[model samples]
Target: MHRFANPTRFLRLAAAVLPFSAAVAALCLGAGLVWGLFFAPPDYQQGDTVRIMFIHVPSAMMAMGVYAGMAISSAIALIWRHAIADLIAKASAPIGATFTFICLLTGSLWGKPMWGTWWVWDARLTSMLIMLFIYLGYMALWQAFDDQTKAARAAAILALVGAINLPVIKFSVEWWNTLHQPASLITMEGPKIHESLLWPLLLMIVGFGAYYLTVLIFRVRAEIHQRRTRMLRMAQADRHNAMQAAD
Candidate 1:
């Protein structure tokens, strides 16, 4: 934690990990999509329409996972003042939001075929929508402040507060009757999905996680460089002002 706080050390670690993450993401996504789309058996009831689950399920899972990660990073930044943690949280928001958007879009697409409607106010669907709003709000909060430090603090608090929605999203199906299906992959008894479908879904989930890591490294690295550039310009301005005062 503290050891990796330094930008240089973090950058070195990211460089080492980036190639592996990228490779795994590419391999898993390619294999999973091919297996899920072409090889796996379709749902007996839904037929080809079931194929959308490969993308929708993984993106939905990743949306929550990424937000959980952001909240954890925000907590670290607030508690330990880990310099890299705030940047990680900032970098994760857009990616999480994109995943959330994909989940909602695909869910709507899948729903129209299965449920005879493109939209619903079901517990799971509504909570997932709220999660998307929270992600957007978190990103907006960061931009609300001119001072990065203040922005980070405000965003961190919002992230921590927004975390309450996560459980709601997760358990919404159980808490109420909903058109959405209950948990299949993570049931207490075990995954209810058959092996052929399950394997490809698992692969997609892993790929999504790896992809998030790959992109996070790039975004965080860019953020570090941008912050450094901003600091340098500010210092130069201060020095010029000092020189003027001396003259």
Candidate 2:
């Protein structure tokens, strides 16, 4: 694991995985949306409003899931000083943040019909909102310092601290009588969602996840290349100065 921590080596590995990931994400997403939107039956209660579930639920799941991933990466980076982990955490931030935002937006849209309001002060909703802020904070910390090691350590600790929010978001329903619904997919007796809506919803969730992974690899690779380029330029400048001094 440490051996692959070298950015150059990570770049090579990422390059190899990129094509396969891209293909899988694209295929899964395509099929998932088609099945979710078209083939699936509308909810008896929510009707076409249920259509939002295809996009909303998956994005919400990914939002939390991605943050968890970021937290784990942050831990690895802080403990092992794994270079690639920082790259991954940095790359995952915007994607996860976007998903969280999407979850909130779509939920509002879904709520306007069902809950009769665009927003709620429920625990789940609030915690998720906080999670979004945490994402922004993590990104800010990474860029706040001029020193790389200091920045990474600071951001990693912040991420770890924020991890408490993950479980809060997960069990918010059971912990309190919030407006948010309970778990539909990963439940005590399996999914409570009907088969018609269930499969498509799952597909979309998976597709969204794959999409995040596809972009994460590309972004991290670019970051590695950019750092390498910066190093090369600095080295070139130093060598040029040394040669001039010799002359």
lDDT of the candidates, in the order given = 0.85, 0.78
- Kindly give the stretch of ten consecutive residues in candidate 2 with the minimal lDDT sum: 182-191
Tens-place lDDT per residue, model 2, 1-247, is: 3123567677678788888878877888899888888888876666777888778788888988998899999999988988889888888999999999998788778768776788855455666677788889889898999876688788888888889655765576446643445433221123257888887777787778778988999898887877777778888999999999999
Q: For candidate 2, list the clashing residue pairs, or say none.
A: none
Q: Specify the highest-lDDT model's number.
A: 1
In model 1, residue pairs whose N, Cα or C atoms come closer than 3 Å (at least 3 residues apart or on different chains), thus clashing, are none
TM-score per candidate, chains pooled: 0.89, 0.86
- Please identify model 2 stretches exceeding 4 Å from their true place: 1-5, 165-191
RMSD of 1: 4.2
lDDT for position 92 in model 1: 100
